[model samples]
Each structure stands twice: as C-alpha cells, then as structure tokens.
Target chain A: MAVTGMQAELTLGPIPFHWSREEKRDFYARIADEAPVATVYLGEVICSKRAPFFETEIPETAERLERGGKRVVLSSLAEVMLTRERKATADLADMDGVEIEINNAAGLLARAGRPHRVGPFMNAYNEDAIAWLARGGATHVCLPAELPGEAIAVAARAAAALGVEVEYQVFGRAPLAVSARCYHARAHGRTKDNCQFVCEEDADGMPLATRDGRPFLRVNGIQTLSESYVCLVGEAGALAKAGVGHLRLMPQAVDMVGVARAFRDCLDGRKDPAEAEAELVGLCPGTRFSNGFYHGVAGYRKIAADAAAMADR
Target chain B: MTQAELVCPAGTPAALRTAVDAGADAVYCGFRNATNARNFPGLNFTPEELAEAVAYAHRGGAKVLLALNTYPPAGKTALWREAAETGARLGVDAFIVADMGVADHVARTHPGTRLHLSVQAAASSPEAIRYYCESFGVRRVVLPRILTIPEIRAIRKEIPCEIETFVFGNHGLMVEGRCSLTNYVTGQSTNMDGVCSPASDVEYVRSADGSMSSCLGGVTIDRFAPDEKAGYPTICKGRYLAPHRAEGYYAFEEPVSLNLARMLPELVAAGVHAFKIEGRQRSKSYVRSVVSAFRRAVDDIRAGVAPDLADLVALTEGQKETQGAFRTKKWR
Candidate 1:
C-alpha cells in the first residue's frame, strides 16, 4: 500500500519559538481565520517553561481553530523531561477530543493508552518504530526533518499500509535540536531555571553565527533550528510521487498567511513550484533556502538543478 | 573487580599511538567520514590508516573502538555499513553506534564484534539502556553526561550493559547524539553528520576596545574581552542576553572541564566499568598527557592508593575543572 494526496492537507506545525500569550492567541486566531491549513498544532514544542504563559490560552485557541474549520492538535514538549514535564504530558493526553502530537517517548507512552498523532520530534526512521507507533494508536506521524526523499517514500508506503496519515515539514526553519540548557537562558546570564522568559524577545529566535561570520543557526530558548528555511516547494512532485499525504508549515512571524497560500496553490497544482519558490523566497527576511536534506546532500546546498528538475517534472 | 578502564579519544593516528602508549586501556577514533561525530578536517583515520592503528593498539595491549555512531542518511546506508565492516575486519574492540539502524546492521553482520552504544544515543535511564541491550546486544553504553552519581548508580542497578562514563575533556548537558543545534545554523549536525560548527565555518573577529566576537557561520556566538580567553564557537556554549541580567552570559554551560580524576573511586563504586576522556580533536601530546595521568590515577585507585588529581588542572577547560553532573545534580 502507498499513500496518496487524496486530501489537500496542510498542518500548522507547533511554533518553534516563544511568544507572548497575546501574540500566540492572535497568531492562532489568524491561522484559524485566514490560513488555508486543514490542521493546526498548538502548544510549546520547544521549552517546557514557556508553556505556563499560554497554558490557559490553549483551550480557547483550540476552540477558535475548531470553529474556523481546522483540526487542532496539541503538541508535547520535545526534550529534557522532568517529573513535572511527564505530568504535563499526561495532562495533555487526558484532554478530550483535542488530538495530542507525541513529541517524546514519554509523550508517546502517555498518549499510548489512546489514539493520537506522533509529532516530528520522535525518531520514526524505520518500519519497526513506525509499526510500533501504529499499534500504539498513532493515527498520523510526521516524519523527521532530516529524512531524505527515498526514506520518506519508504515510510509513506509503510504508514499507508498501516492506515496512518504521513506528514512532512514543507516550510519554516527545520527544528534541529532540543537541549536541557536553554541557549536563551545562557545568553541572558541565567541558567535554565532562571531563564526569565528571555527567549520571548526573539520572535523568530536569535540568529547564531559561525566563528567566521556565517549565519549558521538560531537559538530559541531550549530549541535550536536550522538557519536555512527548509523549502519543499520544489520537492512537491517528488513528495507527491513518494505518496506524502500532508504538508506541515511551521508558523513564522511574518507573511505566514501568504506562505500558506503559496504552498496551498502549489500543492493544488494551481501554481508552478518555481513560481511558488520565488514567492516564498521573497517573503522571508535575511534567510537563504535549501532542500538538500530531502535529496541526501549537505542541508544548506541549494541544488538549483534538482529544484529545476523537480519543477520541470 | 577490575580497575576501571581508561577510554581515550584519538582524532589522528599519532594521537592513537600516543593514547595507547600513555596507558589507555582503550582508545576510540573515527574513520574520516560521517560515521564518527567529530568529522572535522585533518582529523579521523582513513580506512587503511585505521587498520594499522587498530593493529598497533592491539599489539600494545590496548583496545581500539571505532566510532561509527552518526545516523545514516536516507538511502545511504553503505557508508555506515562499510565503516562497521571495516572496524570488525581490523579487529577493533567495538563499534560505537548511536543510530539504531547502524547498530542493527553491525550486530547482524558482525556477530562477534562488540558494540558499545554512543552517548549520542542519549540513553540516560535504565529502561533506555535495557532497550538497547535486549535489542542489539549492546555490550556497553557511553552514558550521556547529564546524570548525577546517584542517578548513575540507580541506572546501573537495572541495565544489562556495562556503563562507561566520561571522566575528562569537554562536557555537554544537551541530549547527546540527538542534538542538531549545530545543524540549525551551519547546516552540519554533530549527530547526523558527525560535524558541529565545522572549523571551516568559524571566524574570530577583533572588536574595538580589545574585545573579540567569535562567530560560527556568520552569527555571533560569544563576545569576549581581550583578557578573557575565547572558548570554542559552538552555538549552545555561547553567551546571549536575558532579562534580569545586565549583559550577555553563557546560556548553556560555561567553558568548563569534566575532570572526574578526583571521583574515580566514587565512579567505580557506582558500577562504572570505563572512564572516557573526550577530546578527539586535541593534540597528540594532550592525549599522551591526559591518558598517562588518568592511567596512574586508575591504577593507584585499584591498588588502594589515593589518586592524585592535581596535574590535571593544566589540561582542563578554562584552566578550571568540575566534577560536573557526575557528582551532583545541583551543578545546573
């Protein structure tokens, strides 16, 4: 069995950076109203501390998304779980009707006694892990950002056979790592315990540089993301051919609605991928684009020929 | 009750020889490929060179573990598989693997070849370690450096594998083998590619007032005063701004050393089988000096002598060392 895009699906990936409660509420409200996404994921996927500010805002936000005709899925924290974190994950699992995206093994176990969607953070690289998740009641699984196209195809086939929807990150900076030490905390002369909500200052995260003055990475509290925007606009055909079922675009600070529309147009065959790529590239600030990870190359390498070939197809 | 083995890191063949000669019970090195986490230029052994190095170490009564720990890129299993096969053929002690796929491949193809789980696997709990042991026949696990002595003792009681703990060199609290923080900016991952903030991407620029800013791939990692020593330019170890603070500070960990030289007896008592020294990127002389010091310490501990840990200060990070997360959890 192989997956196919029977439904033109768009999943709003969890916000990778911290924002004010008002900002988060407004962001989701806009996504529910203006975006073309079919599903929206809410909750902190980066830092566990940032969850408190928005904890009360989630139910109303989930209701907003549901009212706007989008499916809402709450995400679990990604790394460095403590007892409190384990309890929070369990609480998320107990939420009725709101689908939970299991990001860590703890979350997987918490949501195991019931049906849920596995988030991108969990490593589902092989058939065995995928089958395990399937048996444990995972209805959908987002593939890891580092997986190339061939592996995606294999996993997509396997997920389809198991009757689970497969999703991939189509836009936004790919989440690279989750850490115990908050980079945001360290940057501000504080430890993770006293981070003082410093990460909220960088709406899109603080840009990190290599020693030689290269724009290398971004530090968003405990979460780290790739500097390059993982553009899959060019890989729509390969992904479609590979039987990918849905595209997940992470919410960025600016022009996100336009980014969503561009992806929507491209996925629906209403726009050329090259045109979509050009539009999406123009929308971002001070960032380059790459999809080399999909083709099994250095992630920053923008293979124009590959993009052009995918476009030609 | 054997003396805890001293496992050292060797980035080059010279370092390999230096480590073995300095009395390391085992030295771990990587092939000059993505198979190892330190895939920097001018480091790691070539396949031909690794065979010779392994033979030299084995003849010297020391073991060599080949690190083939990076995750295999999709449809590109051959490179990792080749590294595993080459390590086995060269009679290396073990294949240090982080990826489950590579571990499975090595275990299936080289049945008798020993397999040690890399810390990059981030198996911190007993259940996590037990999963590896039950599934892949993992003989040992280089545990992540975040656990305290009590936590280590607790996990040791439950897992089936021998626990190898880091005793010296650089320390990180981030989830090992799973961290892509380096890849977020530089397009290289220490886990997937075995390279983090690749040296080619690093640049140090002097600022006015005798201060300097270290950059990795064009982003400022940390700025330092002229009198202050510059640390390595990885993203997590950098200084940044936060509220309730006057200026940028080390957000993750400060430039510190992991010197468990003083805690050898405690670690051994906690059921650790091996003490690992973690600087594969250092000089051969550094390897010789560190391994020699730790070797005496371990031997003296085994012979019921109090280990002298004073000489280790000069080799530590920032000329300061801490027992790190090994002794206490509150260090955070």
Candidate 2:
C-alpha cells in the first residue's frame, strides 16, 4: 500500500461553519504561513445569508493563500434555492481568473463551458456522471464520499481518460445533507430568515445526539454532517492506488496545519499511516474517527483496516 | 386557467391502476431495482409488470413515466441503461431521470422520447433547469420541495420545459439527489440506493413505560409516548438531543407531512404544469386517496370553486401536516 509513486496532493476544502471574519482571516493567514496544503477553497458553500459576512474577506484571503504558493478555488452555495442565491451564483460564475468549484447545479449551469471544479455536492457517482461533468468543462471533481474505493477507482479510470483530476476527502466530518430549512436555527426555535446568526455559536457544528443520548450527527446552519470526522489517513495509500490524485481535508475546528502535516508525512512515506492516525486523534481532541464510508459500511462506523482494505478490493 | 396535470406515484402495478382509475392524469413508477427512487422491498414494477402497466395506463388515458432517477455506481451503469431501454421498449410515456449520465443515455439512445427531470436532480434555479433542457432536451422537471410560489413562478418564466411541484405526502426538506444522511448511519443512500433509512435496518422497540422507540441501524431515531402516534423514523424527520433543548429537538425537521392543497390555485397560477403527490413508499390506498383528493382540487381550481381538501389530514404522516417552505420561509 505504501508503494504508489504518486504523491497525494492535499487540498483544503471551504470552511462549512459560520466562522467570524476575524477568525476566518486568521485561519487563512495561518494556513498561508504554515499549512502544507497545495490548494485552498474559499466561499460560503452553506447558507447564502452568511455570504455577505465574509464575501469581502474572500479575495484578500485568496490572495494571501496564493501568495503562500497555493491555488485558490472559489466555491458556490451548495443549495441555491432563493432568488438572491441565484443572483450570487450568476455573479460568481461571471468572475474570471480563479477556478470556481460548483456545488449546486445552478452554479454548474451558470458556469457552463468555463473551466471549473465539481464539488462533492454535485453527486458525480459514476463514470458517466464524471464524463458528463468533464464534457461540461469540469477540470476536476471531488466525488461524493458515499462512494467506495472500487467505485472511486472506476470513476478515476473514466476521469483519467477524459483528463479530469479526481479528489478524495481524507479528513473532516463528511457533509451528510443540505436542506432548504436551517436546522441550526430551527433547533434554536427560530426560522431561516430571522435566525439572528445563532449558527455562529457552534464553531465546529451543533451536535445532534440520538434519543438514547448518543452523538449521531452535527448541524451547521442548513447542513447535516456526520458526527465522526472522516479520518482516512490509514487508507491514503489505498486511495492513491485508486487513482485519486488529490486528497481533500475539509476545514474543521481542529488544527488543520498539524492535520495536513501528519497526512503529508503519511503520503510521503515518512510516517506510517497508523502513526499518523494516532497523531491525528491526539491533535484533534474530543473528535471521533470514522472511515466506514470508505469501506462501504455505515459512514459513522469505524471498521478495522483488515476488513476495510479487503472491502476496497 | 387550464387544469394542470395531476401526477401521482405508483409503487406497484396495483397502485398504478388505482391511481389511473381514481383519476390521475399521469402515474410515475420505478423498477424494482435501485434504478428508481423508491427501491423499497416488495415495491416497484418488474419489466413485464411495466409493459402491462403501460398498456393499462394507455388504455385509461393515463401515462406511465419510468423513474430512472437514482445515480448508478461507477462501472455499474448497466442496470440504469437497461431500465431506460426496457422502459422505452415497453412504451412508457417518459423517463424521469436524475443523473446526467442516465439523461445522456436516454436522449441519445431513445430519440424523440419525453424526459422529465426528477426532483432528485435538485435543480432549484431557472439556469440549472435550462441547462438540462438545453443539454438533454428535457420536456419537464419535477421541482425540488424547496422553492416558494414566487420562486417557482419566476423560474417558470425563464426555462423552456414544464414545471411539476410536490403537492402532498412526505415533505423532504433535504434536497434530493444530494442528501447522504441515511448513508452515514446505515450505509444506504437515497440518491444511490434509492432507499433512505432502509427497511432492512429498521427496528421498533417498546418500553415498560408504555413508550415506543424507532431505530435505524441500532441508533434511536425517535421516541413516542403511550398515546402519541409514532411516525416512520425517516432520519431527517426524527427527534434528536441538541444543546438548545434538554428533552430533544427536531433538528432537521419534525415528522410532518407537506399538504399544499390550499396552494393549488397559487401553484397553477405560478405556472405549475403538473402537481406531483409523493408517496410511492406508501400503500395503494394512500395513492388512491391522495391522487383523487388532488384531482378534485385541481378540477375545482380550474372551475373557480374552492376545494374540499379537509379530509386529507387522515392520509398524512402522524395525521399532521404543514404548508412547508412553499407558503412561507418561516417554516424553516
């Protein structure tokens, strides 16, 4: 598994949480100065109302990351339901220079024939979807994490023929779902329109525990995410073998710089994957690890590597 | 205004006939495989069943639309392709597709065929709808359960294809074709597997306190009191503990059904070409009642008569309903 000559490029996905302008600038500033990531995605991929809060900081942040020698990709809202959201996507689509990562079909349609990246929200499940996206000027695709490794390999093979880059998320809480209604605001007894930015309270995500009092999921604004962070450091070699060129790390509340360093070490074969996994558990305190979606099991369930590796085959 | 088409769901061949005989203008059904959205056990039509279904629907002046709406896995598109080819051969009226790959295959192989975009595609904007129409020559698109009447009207003015909207049954607040909440807890996906919180993994337990609890993959989704009605533990509709509430909260949504009978006139005026009732996972009776209720309502709207949709609450989940995001954003 450690034998693949292809070094996995680590990319930072957009921060899903509703972080303040100062916190986001500081985070990106540190990411620029310290992180080992090759690419960084910026923009509001969740609620459109949150876009104004940090829209001004995106260019400055993108310039900062670019100055740090990382490619910057601007992302669109995942659920483009409102009229304002549609306008925002059209505006983003009209922008030139930086590549846009389309999360919703509205963005994809708006940016037709333009070089862009397909975010995981687009649901490129199979080779056919990849081919379709590639034909529509998609240069790269971050596949839905619900897909198993074999599926990824098959998609990668299809994508390889079409000359499209494939990205697999190796870290962070897998974004499970996006709804029209804001669950974060709903939980706080408010509506999507008048929620008063209550989502800012949960920097990581609001935990959604089961009736039995077990943490099952997390809510960040309108999105529902898996409770466990997808820690695929143990399977980086397996993913690379599956023709995955880039391994994406979603920006979590954890120390992403250290997280990237540990994955970079594992991918470079300097540190064992198991050691990196252990290192990540220590680095991100109070976080549970899961890689079951990689193994074709319940995404929140962490399976043993022997079973996981076998399942990938 | 002209009477809009009354679209209905058909989980089985019986449901198809029931909806047609009960006055559905169009009936949508999927194969018994994952190619369709409602891939539940003991539901959906076989290829042979689809042939008879087409014949029956055609005889009754109702159309049969095949729902090839689920995404096929990489290296596993044969099923979806075969389903579309088979449906085309069976003389089905149209193919309701979600995945672009499936849409591409349908457009190329079955030329001059009707293609309706499934809500599972989650194409919420006019530009997105136009993209599908331009790329695949889509005839219609089932609008996702997210937009308001104004948004729908505004979207209608921009796209070339006809617009269909959900009027009754399960209110999926989560955008279809993109949701993976069930996949996280059960490894079963709505977009891929066409099953959410799949029946195979579902369990119900009763406690000594005369309370009932529903779980999926051994994780408790929701609990019910002795006299409280327990709805199916569709993960999004279930209750969960959040710091905002000590007892619990319906973080995503409560177990409420979307009954937009009151908004039919507005929807029709908003340029809705079809009104879809979503309950293929439900029984034939549910199909019959919902389709007929909506049928009369659509007719009443056309006749300038107020609809009598009060009895519809009996057919809803937990016998509770809401206008959802269609009436107001405050429902969010």
Best-performing candidate as measured by lDDT: 2
Question: Per-residue CA lDDT of candidate 2, range A133-243, in tens?
Answer: 898999999999889776888898888889899998989999888888888888878888899999999999999898888988989998988889999998888778778
Please, what is the whole-model Cα lDDT of each candidate in the order they appear? 0.78, 0.88
DockQ (CA atoms), all models: 0.26, 0.82
TM-score of each model, in listed order:
0.82, 0.97
Query: Where is model 2 more than 4 Å wrong at Cα?
Result: A1-6, B310-318
- Residue range A137-160, candidate 1, lDDT tens digits: 888889888776777887787788
Error of 2 at B93 (Å): 0.7
User: Retained native contacts per candidate, as fractions?
Assistant: 0.23, 0.85
What tens-digit string does per-residue lDDT give for candidate 1 at B37-92?
A: 99989999988899899889989999998898887654556788888877888889
**DockQ of candidate model 1:** 0.26
lDDT of 2 by residue, B31-57 (tens): 998998889999999899999999999
